[model samples]
Target: MTTSTQIQRLAIVTGASTGIGRATAVRLAADGFHVLAGVRKRSDGDRIASSRIEPIILDVTNDEHIAALVERVAQDPAGRPLSVLVNNAGVAVNAPVEVLSLDDWRFQFDVSVFGQIALIRALLPTLLSTRGRVLNVTSVGGRVAMANFGAYSAAKFAMEAVSDSLRREVEPFGVAVVKITPGAVSTNLTESGLAAAARVTDTMTPEQRRRYAELSRAFIAQAEGFARDGVSPEHAAAVISKAVNARRPKTRYTIGRDGAMFTFMPRIVSDRLLDAMLRSQNKSLAQEKR
Candidate 1:
């Protein structure tokens, strides 16, 4: 029989197969919570599992996976109460809105927007019972939409709104919702986004490619720089752990210098000014690459 003292706080972290998710899972475990690290593949699950971190096969977009996760929380073997849900699963499909296919757009929203909401809705009952918190890992693009990040930015912006709405709805009931926006954490996301962009470029017509090829190249170069100069997954994870453990956590947290700038600068700068600044930066980066 599980004793009351044996019960531990439980945290569910999606996208735990790599990067920020993996780091967050490890950090939370070290902080004494039993983390249910969600991964889509068994190999990934095996890779992240540890004494305090159990791996769960969870594709947030899948109804069955979400249901299984809810069931797992409901019947914890150690009677651990659900404490936090980290919605970190996301994909970046960077291509101009005019050139990106509807399928790609759907895929981006499916993973980032719909998937997060699906999991939240499925787990809300248990979370409400435990007065748990929800942490959404949004992006700087959410605040300042870029030239080629239409789909990704749109989804992140939607999540930002959802986080606000949910927070207001659940705050009176003791639940907190926090958003973590990272500037450019050193992760596999850049490589993945570039690959997706390449595919979209291939599908573009000659005229379309002629119009946007140089810009895409610049975007690629800048994205690479962002990854190279960004903070580590461990650093982002540490900040997340701090938020998780804070008695009165802030509604939003920015990970790096760029993260803080992009999050707050948009509030002060005019849209045209931001556009001009981004265009100049992109042009310089493109010229450098050439």
Candidate 2:
């Protein structure tokens, strides 16, 4: 009989160019899984490739890339069973619902929601065969939608629902679906989000700008603060690793104190109270910029 030690395990992590995805890829490789690290550019793939971590070009929004990834998994030279799929590729485009273009909203959902689901559909067969785990790197935004974050938050909220539905659908089949909800981490998201926010602000009408410009700045400041005070990608990776390795993992795993708080805060607090709290915090952040 083949011992568990003798069987090689394969894990795939998307958006592995940097931050949490990169960290998780490295962590899983260290844990003895042969990792397929997904990156958008060839240079990035080259940068992250290792003996145990093979970098693959994967733009989650691209169907051809998705097909290629499925093929790669099917043709693993070592015949290892795929044990984990980390749906970590996501982009945040933050703007007021009225100000953000329909195209922008669709783009956010395209990468964060549809792309994630597409990959899962492609790999569900292999995952089912191996009784593998699916780890979705979602955000606290899913639970608490904040002002000026409607597009990004909506996508996360959708994924949260998807995660719940998927867990129920797959759990009985021996496939584990875990949501890795992170509040904030010192990643490039803040910088990218700020840039996107600036572009959106430029497109706003003068009336719209007058209404939301300061609020947008406040949101930007808050994002920067989150990045400055947030946990490291390695810490997020450790949390994710725990979820991946657990024999019977919880349906959801929150990464930080903020994650835990915001996730459950909605359950305990009334919407009116939550709104007041968010308003107060945004006001404080806006003042700090003065």
Candidate 3:
């Protein structure tokens, strides 16, 4: 028989196969939440589940999957109002605006923007029923621009705007929208992003290629450095968990040292100065690749 303490809150976490999403799902399960881990692949879903975490096949890009997940959660015996919805599934495609293919641009926007919005729309009814919390996992890139990451930054910026609007709109309904931005957490995204950068640059004009090559390499190197310095996914999960449980959760939570610095520095520094600083970083990165 399951004890009251064992009676878990129901949470649906997208992108639970790896990185922050996986960590959040696991941590929530450990915290006595019956986690519905969402992954694109069945294999990844299976990998996400254990005695505590229950995996669910979810492809954010698929409408059927999102609808099916909502129905499944609604039918749970726990009938517990969906306590949390963590929108953590996202992809990064780093390329210069000129060189980036339309498909690549749309792909990033689809997963990070359209898909995320769709999931929230599908689940908003459940969240409203339970007066639950919605956590949008944004990135520090959303707040500031980075060369070679225009596509990713654009999507994130749009997501942040979406989150801000939703936060205000949902407050009266007692559903809180929280935005958590992490600077860099050791994850495969950097490696994959670098690989995509290489692929995109291959089709670029010689001058465009020459300009982006060093910049891209430097960007990758920086990403690698971030991965090395980044806190574990578990650490990010813990911080998120606290936000979920807090009596008065803040609208925004910035994770990691770099995240905090980038988030707050803008208030103290002039925009032009900040732009110069960022440009300088890019220039230095380019030089390093030479």
TM-score of each: 0.97, 0.97, 0.95
Model 3, 1-290: lDDT tens per residue? 23354355788888898988999998888777888999878889777778778888888999999889989888987666588999999998988888899999999999999999999999998888888999999999888877778899999999999999999998899999999999889987777777887788788898997776777767867877768888889999988988877778999998999889988887899989998898888778667667
What's the lDDT for all of these models? 0.92, 0.91, 0.86
The runs of at least 3 residues in candidate 3 whose Cα sits more than 4 Å from the true structure, single-residue gaps closed, are 1-6
Better of 2 and 3 by TM-score: 2
lDDT of 2: 0.91
After superposition, the stretches of candidate 2 with alpha carbons farther than 4 Å from their true spots are 1-7
Which wins on TM-score, candidate 1 or candidate 3? 1
RMSD of 1: 2.5
**Residue 118 lDDT (model 1):** 96
TM-score for candidate 3, please give it.
0.95
Report model 1's TM-score to 2 decimal places: 0.97
> Model 3, clash count?
0
lDDT at position 264, candidate 1 = 91
Ranking by lDDT: 1, 2, 3
Clashing residue pairs found in predicted model 3? none
| Runs in model 1 lying further than 4 Å from the true structure | 1-7
What lDDT does model 1 reach? 0.92
